[model samples]
Target: MLQVRVSTFSAKQLVFSNIDNEFIQLAHPRLWMQRICKRVGLPILSPHALRHTFATLLFSKDVNIKFVSILLGHSSAAFTIDVYADVY
Candidate 1:
């Protein structure tokens, strides 16, 4: 967690506020994230990092790459394997 501080009455708030109860797009609030990390002590997260973590966690759980590839919407399981071979 970035552990960012806000002056809310509760002393805890979701910094990267969301809208529409939807997932955040990769480029959504990009500059805001950079500025927040610049102020906080957290490293800048790459756009692919979340995807990479999803794949890596699946691999760690012994999930088949073919299933993961299908879930990832990749053209082929082989391509997914190729891209995340290090995690395997």
Candidate 2:
């Protein structure tokens, strides 16, 4: 099992912010990722790719499938297995 740190913050706080410390709009993170990838000479990846990678990594680590499904907001572990069977 993984242990996560617990912190207290306001419900309205932004998880990510712009350079000026203002709230970031929905598309800002993807645009920033594209710009950074171009600047660093790396292939641009979509947020969905990152999410898939995260799931693959977790599956590789032998975490419980049900737990991973919950984290990914899947309706059931069977769906997660069906989607990521290649990872296994």
Candidate 3:
């Protein structure tokens, strides 16, 4: 058997914890997203925008739509093509 060793650190030392203690609790995805948007000086956008952005970027990079659909957990490749064909 192969062995993998992991290092453990206190929550205080974690990068996510450095972002916000509130992240320690399960809150809205939008809350953290809004924080990031504001920090970057962009208009506040829903978390879904990130998914759409990923799909659009992958399309621009010429990654296959079927692969993108699977990564996005869509049930059908045609659905992915239908939804983002205009952007592509």
Candidate with top lDDT is: 2
Per-residue lDDT for 47 in model 3?
A: 70
Name model 3 segments beyond 4 Å from true: 1-27
- Clashing pairs for model 3 are none
Per-residue accuracy of model 1 over 2-88 as CA lDDT, tens digit each: 554444454235334553333555576677667777788789875467678988999999998899999888999999989998878
Candidate 2 achieves a global lDDT of 0.81
lDDT of 3 by residue, 1-88 (tens): 8443322454345323324332454456778989989999999997789889989999999998889999888899998988987996
**Candidate 1 whole-model C-alpha lDDT, 0 to 1:** 0.74
Note the residue pairs that clash in candidate 2.
none
- Residue 20 of model 1, lDDT score: 31
> Model 2, which residues run further than 4 Å from truth?
1-25
Quantify all predictions' global Cα lDDT against the true fold: 0.74, 0.81, 0.76
- Comparing 2 and 3 by lDDT, which wins? 2
* Residue 73 displacement in candidate 1 (angstroms): 0.9
Question: How does model 3 fare in lDDT?
Answer: 0.76
Worst lDDT run of 10 residues, candidate 3, spans 14-23
TM-score of each: 0.60, 0.69, 0.64
Candidate of highest TM-score:
2
